[model samples]
Target: MTKRSDFLAANKGLRVARAGFVLLVLPHAAPDAGDIRRFGITVTKKIGNAVVRNRMKRRFRALVREILPEHGLAGHDHVLIGREGGVERDFALLRKELLVALDRARAGKGDPPRGAKGGRGGGKPHHGRGKGPRPAPESPQT
Candidate 1:
């Protein structure tokens, strides 16, 4: 993406988490001329050394090259974030995960998957931090 805000904005869009990577898909508000799809791949240093990171990035690019043309939605921006398993995982499995993630994302089936924390307030009940009615004092017996 041209700006950091664009990548940040994509984070609010649909997300699919696989063992090897996380896919973020955001649909464009207006399809530009040529209807071309754009994509980005990120391999963090935390994943490995420079060599490993580059390898992961290359693998991701190849995967996108093979998959996105026919399967990806035009006017949608796709970002692939590499994870710890990205370099070690089998290529075939990675492909399967990507395809499944894409289908689920488009179908809107994987938004906040099962057992995930609920949205807003971080799934915690708000009780005003122990604020409640005071207990009444004991009355004197007759």
Candidate 2:
């Protein structure tokens, strides 16, 4: 899990959404004999400035430390992505959400509900101002 490849692989795995954050779980296909569960925390700049992001990371790390040992499975990789409200969200609520999300993900119910369409362009495509070039700039007479 120390490698970037592991993180990238985990990105393609199961995703569970919570109010404060999102959890990605990927079971290792061929874990080393000594390999246990591994996890990562990611709080992007979109969440806040450096200070706020760091605080979120610290909080998430603490949450993982407390939750993973009992609830996490061996030979799996989990990555937690902090959401917008994560910085100020209640720790207890976040913990509960994490646990519930994990259970749903394991049960294969974490996926979007039926008839739920995902991604962009689900609606009519925007013409974007007729897709024409801008008018030529008028040259100022010197």
Q: Estimate each model's TM-score.
A: 0.76, 0.77
Off by over 4 Å in 1: 31-34, 113-120, 123-142
lDDT of 2 by residue, 18-123 (tens): 8799888888867572447789988888999999999999999999999988888667888998999888899999999999987887786766532356656367
In Å, residue 40's CA in model 2 sits off its true spot by 0.5
After superposing candidate 2 on the true structure, give the runs of residues whose Cα lies further than 4 Å from its correct spot.
Answer: 31-35, 113-142
Best by TM-score: 2
Give lDDT: candidate 1, residue 92.
Answer: 94
Which residue pairs collide, candidate 2? none
TM-score of 1: 0.76
Tens digits of per-residue lDDT for model 1, 19-124:
9999988887564625677788877789989999999999999999999998886778888989998899999999999999889888976556335675463565
List the RMSD of every prediction in angstroms. Answer: 3.8, 8.0
User: How badly does each model clash, as a count of residue pairs?
Assistant: 0, 0
Cand. 2 TM to true fold: 0.77
